[model samples]
Target: MIILYNLVLLVMRAGYNIAALFHNKARAFVTGRKDVFTKLGDYFRQNHAKVVWVHCASLGEFEQGRPLIESIKKEYPQTKILLTFFSPSGYEVRKNYDQADFIGYLPWDSAANAERFISIVKPTLAVFVKYEFWHHYAKALKQHQIPLLSVSSIFREEQMFFKPYGGFYRGILKNFSYFFVQNETSLHLLKSIGIDACAVAGDTRFDRVYAIVKQGGEIPVARQFKSDQKTFVVGSCWPEDFEVLTPLINENRIKFIIAPHEITETFMAAMESSLQVKSVRFSQAAGKPLEDYQVLIIDNIGMLSRLYRYGEFAFIGGAYGKGLHNILEAACYGVPIFFGNKDYEKYQEAVDLINRGGAFEVRDYTDLKAKYEMLNSPETFLLACEVTRLYVEENLGATEKIMHYCRTLLA
Candidate 1:
């Protein structure tokens, strides 16, 4: 299976190389790793600091792992943090993040690469955030006697590890010193698979988002744009999200701030054309009285989490498409959430919020309009707000729980 995995990695590398010619993201994936080992080696050689290596699959996983990273740094101030990302999205956005002592792309998951990476980093402890299970990396860390942990993990029965012919994949699960899963279902799944080195740790994203809420207030630009109106924040929106939202925007009197997942010029132009109300791009909204425009379009990234503070209600995108984006970011602000009906199962918080009546799924414009009307009522809105606030409050401390176990293991 290891040999087969190596072969698969080779094929994937080749395929990505070919795709790089025509696709910008593929190009970035290839180009970003061109001198990754050399860079990592130079950095490690210059600094003999004890390292805690944290690997994330992408931006979302990075957010899930962030609270733990901050906790570890606080507890062990002298220890250097090494963060690695498998996806360009995470590395590109957080490459210069000050929290991690070193940040780089994770090399391909071949045995040789994993062995070399482990040797160079010499991590005292290694952490993989949710859904990142590289067989060679786990094996290399184990062989080095380094503590390896998987945090905020979620497992379902349908996954290969629980399958009848999944022994090879299941072997990877044994490499972890411990697993901090998100729910009881995952704990039960691991137990059924005879892997008892696990415990329920809830989701670290709650800790991260909740922390954001406590520290969050007053983004001058966002506040000015909102003009104290009942704002509707559409975060990480796609074209599909706009299909349902466009009609609602036209029919309603609510103010809007749209932060599309992609900020391509074409998409921004399309958004401007879709709305009948006066709208202005965030970058250009400076100096002008923001009250003049009904819609404020965020044309950049990194502010969507903070932007939620300006909203009374939010529609998080991606539920209608691939999967849901972080609904927790908005929920932390005690705002009711609306998203498309599909793919909500993958996000436990979304399901929980829906059950608590703080979130609602819309199939189309009709459903969206109806929910909008219902939530617009002062009593209904306040009830939704209170439910969301309680949900976020209940989910706190996952980071502290995971950190407690980690300190014991490290000690």
Candidate 2:
């Protein structure tokens, strides 16, 4: 089985190199491992402080670990951070983050490469964000006796861990010194596998988002649409989300800021053509002051999470596809949220929020109209807003729990 796993890794590496000819992400797949080691070798020779290595799979996991990273910085001022990302998205966006002393794509997790990379960094502590589990990397850490921990771990039966042929993967779970899972369901899942180094630490993203909600930003454009009135931010939206929402914007007594997930020209054209009112793309309207249009179509990225702070209500996107967008971002503002019900199972926060009356999952246009009307009454709308805020407050402490656990493991 072990030999088969090695063969699989070899083929995967070879396949990735071939794919690199077409896609930019596969660049790391074919990089010279010796050169990678040489670069790290030079960096390591100069670093005198104990290093804390943190790995996050993508942007979502990066956000989940941001609060923890900042917390570590404050607590262990002398420690150096070696943050590695498996996905380009996280590495690209957060490469400039102040806390990470060294940020790069994690070398492909072959045993030899993992061992070489681990030995060079000499990480005093290692943290894995969310669900990424690379067997070679974990095994190397264990061999070096570096305490491995997972922050904001969430497990489900549908994952590879619970599959019938998941023994090789399941064997890797025991490498962690502790697992700070998002909920009891995940802790129970870990326990079922006899890997009980776990706790229900919730998610650090709520901590990061709630912190954002508290620190308000000037949405010079969005403010124009609101003008001292209630505004809904439809965030990280795709075409399907906009297709369902464009009709609702025609209704009177509602204001909107539609921040589509992709800000491409094609998507902006579709949004403008679909809407009933005068709409302006954010890129085009960047020089203009807020209030030039009834609907502000945000053809920009990086601001959607922060934009949630300005909204009385929010409708996150992605439910029309594989899962719901970041409902938690809006939830942290205590803003009531709405979304389609297509990919409902993947988003635990949405299900939990709707069950608590802090969110709504619109089944169809009919259900959307009913909910919108119910919120039309000023009194009921204010009540709903309060429910949303209260929900955020109720779930505010996950970061503290995670921070405490990390401190114990940090050098």
Candidate 3:
């Protein structure tokens, strides 16, 4: 199984290199790791400080781990932090994150790379967020007697660890010193598999979103566009999302703030063409009367999370195609949420929200229209708002729980 896994990784590396010829993100993934070891060695050698390393697979996992990272920095100001990502999306966006003392891409998961990386960084404590379960890295950390924690993790019965021929994968779980999982199902699943160093800590993303709500930021364009009217926020929208939403947007009953996942010129132009209502790009909104446009298209990144503050309702994208974007960002603002009815079961929050009536899942344009009308009722909308708010508040403190365990390890 180990050999097979290594072979698969090698094949993936080759495929990514080939895909880099035409794919921007693939190019980034390939080029970003060109001198990763040299960069890691240079930084670590210059600073012989006690380091805590946090590894996140992508941006989503980074959000789940961010509260813990910030908490560690605040509590142990002298301890240096090393943050690594496997995906370019995570590293590229957060490369200049000031909190982490060092940021780099994690070398591909191989025994030699793992041994070399563990020796170079010498992290006193290593934290893997959410779905990061690198086999060789976990083994290397255990051999070095370092405390490795898996935080905000969730397990399902269908995962390889619970399969009949999953002995090797189950061994990887044993390498972790402790697991701070998201729910009772995950806790019970681990115990069933004979892995007991775990507890239900909920999800750290709740803490992250709550913090965002408190430290409010200003977006004058979004505020002006939303003034004196109900606004629907469409965050992380892809073409699939737009296919179902274009009709509703054309109706122009309320204001809209559409922030697409990819802010490419072509996609933005297409999106604008699809809408019959008057619209303006965020970049082009300067000096123009924002209230004059029915649609305000965000032509940049980093503002979608904060834009939720100006929304009465939200439709998060990605479930129609791949995975869903972070719905909690809008939910924390007490906004009624909606999304495509696919690829969402893995996200426990989405499932919980649907069950609690805090969120709705629509199959297509008709489904979306019906659900929207149902929620339009004042009593129903207000109830959903309260549900979402309370859900976020109740899930608070996962980061603190995980931090208590981290304190013991760092001490």
Candidate 4:
């Protein structure tokens, strides 16, 4: 099984190298790991502090792991954090994150790389956020007698760990010293497999988003653009979502602020071409009269969370394509969120919000229009807002529970 996994990694690395020639993201994935071991070794040699390693697969997982990271920094001020990402999406965005002492790409999951990495870092503890289970890395951590934790984890029966021919994969779960899972289903799944070093700690992202609400300050541009108008914020949108949303945007009933998932020149231009109403990109809005335009296009990243503060409604995109982006970012603001009605069942919050009447799923233009109109009434809108707000508040404190467990482990 280990040999087969190594073979798969080898093939994937070769495939990515070839793909790098033509793709920017693929190129980043290949180039970012260049001399990563030398970098890790050089950084750790002089530091020699008690290090806690936190591994996240991408940006979403980073958000899920962030509250815990910051909390660890606060409680264990002397302990150094080594944060690693498996994808460029997370590494590129948060490479310079201040909470972690060291941040880098996780060297691809080979036994040799894992052994070398463990030896070089010599962490007191290792943490894997959400679905980041690496066979070789888990084994290496166990060999070194390091405590490994799985945080904000969820498991489904369809996963290999529960399957008839999945003993190799199931062995990976046993490597973890403990698990802080998201819900009862995950707890039940692990218990059924005879893995009892786990508990339901909910999701750390709830704590993270609530912190954002407390710390959120005003974005001058967002405030200026909104300027007393009923605004709709569109976050992490894709071309597919835009196709369904463009007609509604053209109607110009309410002001719209769109932040596309990818800010590529081509996609932005395509979005602009499709919109019939007057619009302005955030970059160029500095000199223009902000209120003159009906649509405001966000041309950069990192402001979507704060941008929700100025909106009364939100459409979080990505469900129209691969999967749903983070609705929790917008939901934290207590807005009635809408998304494309596909592939959102995987998100527990989305399902909960839909059931609680805090969110709605739209299939197309007609679905969007009808559902959106239903929320136009002040009474109905306020009810949804309260539901969404209370939902976020109720889910808080997962980080504290996980931290309490970590205190015992670290002691």
Best by lDDT: 3
- Who is ahead in lDDT, 2 or 4? 4
Taking all chains together, the TM-score of candidate 4 against the true structure is 0.89
lDDT of 1 by residue, 16-54 (tens): 999999999999999999998999999897677678999
C-alpha lDDT score of every prediction, in listed order = 0.91, 0.80, 0.93, 0.92
> Candidate 3: what lDDT?
0.93
Clashes of 1: 0
Regions of candidate 3 where Cα sits further than 4 Å from its true position = 14-31, 264-276, 283-293
lDDT of 1: 0.91
* Model 3 quality (TM-score): 0.90
Tens-digit per-residue lDDT, 112-137, candidate 4: 89999999999999999999999999
Index of the highest-TM-score prediction? 3
Better of 1 and 2 by lDDT: 1
Q: What is candidate 2's lDDT per residue for 1-411, written digit by digit as tens?
A: 668878887898788779879987676435423266677788887788989888999888999888888888889998888888877777778879888888877887788888889878999989999888888899999999998989888898888787889888888898878898888899888888888778987878788887776776776766555677667789888888877787788775567888878778888887888778777766677666555466878876778877876778889888888678778778777677899988876677878877867788887667777897787788877777788778667767887887776676664
What TM-score would every model get versus the actual structure?
Answer: 0.89, 0.89, 0.90, 0.89
Clashing pairs in 3: none
Clashing pairs in 1: none
Model 1: CA > 4 A from native:
45-47, 220-229, 263-293, 299-302, 376-379, 409-411
